[model samples]
Target: EKHLVLLRDGRTLIGFLRSIDQFANLVLHQTVERIHVGKKYGDIPRGIFVVRGENVVLLGEIDLEKESDTPLQQVSIEEILEEQRVEQQAKQESEKLKVQALKERGLSVPRADTLDEY
Candidate 1:
């Protein structure tokens, strides 16, 4: 059966569920990160996944019937990748400004990754 899994790292993977161990480690085939930006969306193929149970935050099945009715425009993987990169750069710049402002006021802000691990 096909499944949509959300990981703790803020990534969503969609694929066929081949198996799951007693610990809930999942085996998925034909996996992909279905990304959306604005009104556009794209899928980046990720062959397979043997996800450790601890990393999974949520797991659910996608209804193929409702999937076909999404209003988002489907775009090429390359286009979506480029857009994602640009968005990240913009966010990094914004974060830098915020950190700098805090520093000027004698306050400290932790690195983005450090804040995300919890």
Candidate 2:
């Protein structure tokens, strides 16, 4: 069965469902992560996976018809990865400024997860 899996850390995997246990642990065959950035996306081949249940945020059957209707443009993996890196860097710079401004005003700002942790 074709399946789409979302990871807690914001990654998406599309593959064939191979097996699952009572705990929701899964084995996926011919897996690849579909990464979306803005109106574009790319697929990074990942092969087989034994996904731990805790890491899965969502799982659903892929609707072939609906999937084909998506408006997002597909790009080469290399290009998309580069775009993602640039986007992340920009976010980090913005966050740094926000954190610094908060500190200057004697405001304590809670730190979010690391910029690259996901």
Query: lDDT scores for all predictions?
Result: 0.90, 0.93
lDDT of 2 by residue, 1-118 (tens): 8999999889999999999988889999999999889999999999998899999899999987788898999999999999999999999999899889999999967665544565
Candidate 1 global Cα RMSD: 2.2
TM-score of each: 0.87, 0.91
| Predicted model with the maximum lDDT | 2
lDDT of 2 at 63: 86
User: How do the residues 1-118 of candidate 1 rate in per-residue lDDT, one tens digit apiece?
Assistant: 8899999888889999999988879999999988877788899899988899999999999998898898899999999888888888999999899999999999998776678655
TM-score of 2: 0.91
Stretches of candidate 1 above 4 Å error? 112-118
| Weakest lDDT window of 10 consecutive positions for candidate 2 | 109-118
Each candidate structure's count of clashing pairs: 0, 0
Give me the overall lDDT of model 1: 0.90
